[model samples]
Target: MHNNLHKTKENTSLTTDSEWAITHNNLTSVYRLMGDLSNALSHLQIALEIRKKVLQANHSIVDVSFNNVGIIYHSKGDHKTARINYQEALEIHRKSLSTVHPRSAETYNNIVFVYDLMSDYSNAVSYYQKTLKIQKKSSLSLIHPDLATTNRNMGCTYAALGDYLTILEFFEKGFNIRKTPLPSAHPDFAKTYKNIGSLFNKKK
Candidate 1:
């Protein structure tokens, strides 16, 4: 995938076509999956630059580029930088769509994760609430993977706050939501199970 995208990128001028930005974005994903975060960030930045040049400042796609770049930074453990990029994406989303947009929810989720990493559990829960509100208000299904993820994350945040019963409720809800769509052997299940197990231990 990386090689194919690299070839496409070489053939297309960044300013001339949006495909060039797409190629870079694809390359960024490929690199991210490979755990080459440095390369992922570089490619993502190129894609962001291309998108900014080709699209309006408030364009949704430009916001997507920013959000994706934030993801790479987040994976790299640069929580502050990730938060900045996420906030930028959120601002763009606010400009481009309604206040309750799913894109805004996604950025809120990203910010929640960063705050979680920063040990700002209060902020994480606040953002998670916003995320859930938007997801529930949007056309997303009740059992959407994103909803499951937010539930699980919120459970973890509650766990950090030593709210064992609340954590269990959230964890159970997330588990129920995910069970239908995600395979039992999925990696996300592993994390959820670990969290539940730890919750039990805490209760003991």
Candidate 2:
């Protein structure tokens, strides 16, 4: 992917506008998955630039580019920059998509994650609730993976706030969802158990 993307860059005159953005975005994802956030950010920035040039300012693809950049910044622990990028993405998503769209919900979840990392539990809960509202109104099932993730994130936020009862409720909801669909050996399934155990230990 790296070599292909670099070759595409070298032959920029041969690449179409959409092709350039797509290749850069794909490279960004590859780098991000490898935890090379610096390269991920660089590629995403290039994608964003290319998209901004070829696509409208409020294009959905532009929103995705911004969101990808936010994810990289969030993973790098630059919560401020992550929040800014997420807000940018959210604004574009809200303008271009329905309120209950999956992308909007995902952006809200991303914002919630940043708030959680910043130790801003109140804001985290607020954004998590937004994500939940959207997910519930959408076609997603109660046991959908995204729903489970939001529930678990809410659990973590409540745990941080010392609301053990609410934490347990949310965690149990998420755990039940994962347990029904995921194999016992799945990492997510194991994580649910671990989270429950940790919360129980905290209570004790």
Candidate 3:
């Protein structure tokens, strides 16, 4: 949020910051917060183009470009394109950062989502496991949404693979975690309970 606010502060040199990347990035963040995804995507695409022209393709800045555009594609329901872009970001992160870096975790998480959207459940499960492993290694176990993501995705993957026991195990863990960390009526907790109930109904 601070970045979103301060991004427009022109340089002290009495001139606009003519850096192509920064301007597009600031616009992208602002548009994203405003729910204007089309504008956000457009700005991010411009940012990526400029970064690629100025920096190496595998650099962190280039990786961010890939990630930002990939997210836009995902939000727009173009999972195939999203997967390719996420793969590019994943490769860049693997080559440049340690495996458990938060950036790498983000790439892994995005890839998992793309695979899930494509109905590639096996690959999705594999990526989700890798994502949780990275998050756990980062020692952010209490981060609500991420913790919920790990549990819910792991449960769904197990359910898809016909491992009902593991599905129940993870879903219950997620439910308990959410109930304690979030208000009991939080949507996350409610959704978890609904899923568990549905799963049990099928077994009856």
Cα RMSD for candidates in order:
4.9, 3.9, 5.9
- The local distance difference test score of each candidate is 0.87, 0.87, 0.79
Q: What is the clash count for each candidate, in the order shown? A: 0, 0, 0
Stretches of model 3 off by over 4 angstroms after superposition: 1-18, 27-42, 142-145, 176-189
Rank by TM-score, highest first. 2, 3, 1
Relative to the unseen true structure, what is the C-alpha lDDT of residue 171 in candidate 2, on a scale of 0 to 100? 93
Residue 19 miss distance in model 1 (angstroms): 4.8
TM-scores for all candidates?
A: 0.73, 0.77, 0.74
User: Which residue pairs in model 1 clash with each other?
Assistant: none
Q: Rank the candidates by lDDT, best first.
A: 1, 2, 3
Question: In model 1, how large is the Cα lDDT of residue 196?
Answer: 94
The candidate 1 region of ten consecutive residues with least summed lDDT is: 8-17
Error of 2 at 147 (Å): 2.2
Output the better candidate (2/3) by lDDT: 2
Model 3 Cα lDDT, one tens digit per residue, 21-86 = 687788889989999889899888877877877777678988988988999989988899888888
**Which residue runs does candidate 2 get wrong by more than 4 Å?**
1-16, 26-36, 175-197
Please report, as a residue range, the 10-residue window in candidate 3 with the lowest summed lDDT.
9-18
The digit string of per-residue lDDT tens for model 1 on 1-204 reads: 657756665766543468887777787778788889999899889888877887899998889888988888898889999999999999898888998888798799889889988999999999999999999999999999988988988998999999999999999989999998877898888888899999998889
